[model samples]
Target: MRCPFCGHEETQVKDSRPSEDGAAIRRRRMCPACEGRFTTFERVQLRELTILKRSGRRTPFDRDKLARSISIAIRKRPIEPERVERMISAIVRQLESMGETELPSSTIGELVMKHLKQLDDVAYVRYASVYRDFRETQDFARFLGEEGLNEVLARER
Candidate 1:
């Protein structure tokens, strides 16, 4: 690794450890010339995946965009951030395992809804309303009824 302090071409790793989240490795480095120490992180980059939009457009898969959508749906909810990250990772893993370079937008939406349904019913409904493009109040009612959320909501009364 290059030294950041002196812009030297060579640096030695002094220590290495897994990050707190276990998602990456933190490495402590030292510059031989300036004796300056610095830290760097390393993470794995999986094979590139593509998203096939409804418009027939293909775009590179974005984990942050996926996280933002889920976060918006679960906003103000009780779900933890770690859980959300795990969910996104699981979804990405599943997509990658399919051995397909491109996947339909609807398939991705279904996967998100499936996971959200288990995480939080309200969040699930909130996401479904947008994903399915609910047109009226009855659409919400029907979805709640079909998902047995009506009964779940009743118990909270």
Candidate 2:
């Protein structure tokens, strides 16, 4: 690595140790020319994630927005906030680990639906109503259709 202080192209690593977080390596270096020393952090490059929206627009991936949406779904519910955060993080990690730079928004929505479905039915329906845009009674009916007909009918009665 180039010496930050001496502007020299060569530097010797005087000491190397693992960072406390273990996410990166902490390296102490000495410049041969100016004898000025400096420290550097090194980490592997992660691939950038791209989101292909339904509107045909491509955007950089964002975790905060996903968390916001999930939080909104579970707002005032019995579910724990940290649980929602963990679900969002799990979904993001799954997508990032796929080794793909680009992903469809539908894929993200499906992940959220699958996770929220497992967490709470109210949250799942809340998220689905916003994402799927149930415009009419029929639309909601069809969405509810995906659930077990016997269970829903039993709930009604």
Candidate 3:
């Protein structure tokens, strides 16, 4: 690593620690010539996973977009932020483990919906409504029927 102070290439790592992310390494370094200490972080770069959209377009994977969508579906709910973060991590892990560089948008949606179902029923319904693009209450009814939640909704209704 080049020293920012003197632009020297001679630097040594003084300390190394694992970052909170556990996927990254944090190092405290010193430029031997300038005696300046600095911190550096290193993380593994994964193969880029592209999301093939239903619009027939392709885009790079975006975690922020996923998080935002989940938050929207979970709005006004009692779900915690940590749980959402954990869910995102779990989804990413599944995608990565598949070792596919390109995946359909529907795959991502299904992964989100699967995990959401385990978290909260209302949140699951909310996510499904937006994700499945339900145009009418009947669409929700149909989804519940398909997912076998129809019997429960019927009892409540």
Candidate 4:
């Protein structure tokens, strides 16, 4: 691997192990030229998946982007980081096993909604506010009512 610190051509792996969730291989490396150390994660990609957007534009699926979106939704929530990581891995694995190279963006959003709904109600609402393009407060009320979460949210408040 290339050294990110000094732009060195090579780095030596000092240790390797499976990630806590067993979805990726975590490697500890050191750059000989700069004596800098860093960690890298390697994951198995079953295939190259593409996302077909609503705008008719196609783009490669990005795990980081998905994680970031989820992170935003769960920020300051009581959820654990490990749970979020596992959820993201599960979503990616499900997409890969779908046997289709190209999938609609809506499919991914729906998967995220499904997982988020099970993970946390607050996070689920946060994500839905954006995914469903909520224009006003009534949109949230409508969604909560539609999902039968009105009573639950009222109890929390």
Q: Tell me the lDDT of candidate 1.
A: 0.87
CA shift of 72, model 2, Å = 1.5
Model 1 weakest lDDT span, ten residues long: 41-50
Clashes of each: 0, 0, 0, 0
Q: Is candidate 1 or candidate 4 better by lDDT?
A: 4
Alpha-carbon TM-score of each model against the true structure:
0.75, 0.66, 0.70, 0.98
Candidate 3 accuracy as lDDT: 0.85
lDDT of 4 by residue, 1-157 (tens): 9999999999999999999899999999999999999999999999999999999999999999999999999999889889999999999999999999999999999999999999998899999999999999999999998999987778767
Q: At residue 13, what lDDT does model 2 achieve?
A: 96
* Candidate 2 vs 3: which has more lDDT: 3
- Candidate closest to the true structure, highest lDDT: 4
Residue 109: error of model 2 in Å? 0.3
- Comparing 2 and 4 on TM-score, the stronger one: 4
Over 1-157, each residue of candidate 2 has an lDDT whose tens digit, in order, gives 8888868999999999976645458899999999998999775436788999999999998877888888898887788765775676678778888889999999999999999988987778788889998888887678778764436445635
lDDT of 1 by residue, 5-32 (tens): 8899999999999866576688999999
Question: Tens digits of per-residue lDDT for model 3 on 1-157?
Answer: 9999999988999999986646558899999998999999775547788999999999999877998999988898888876877788778878878889999999999999999988867778889998889999899878888899866556644
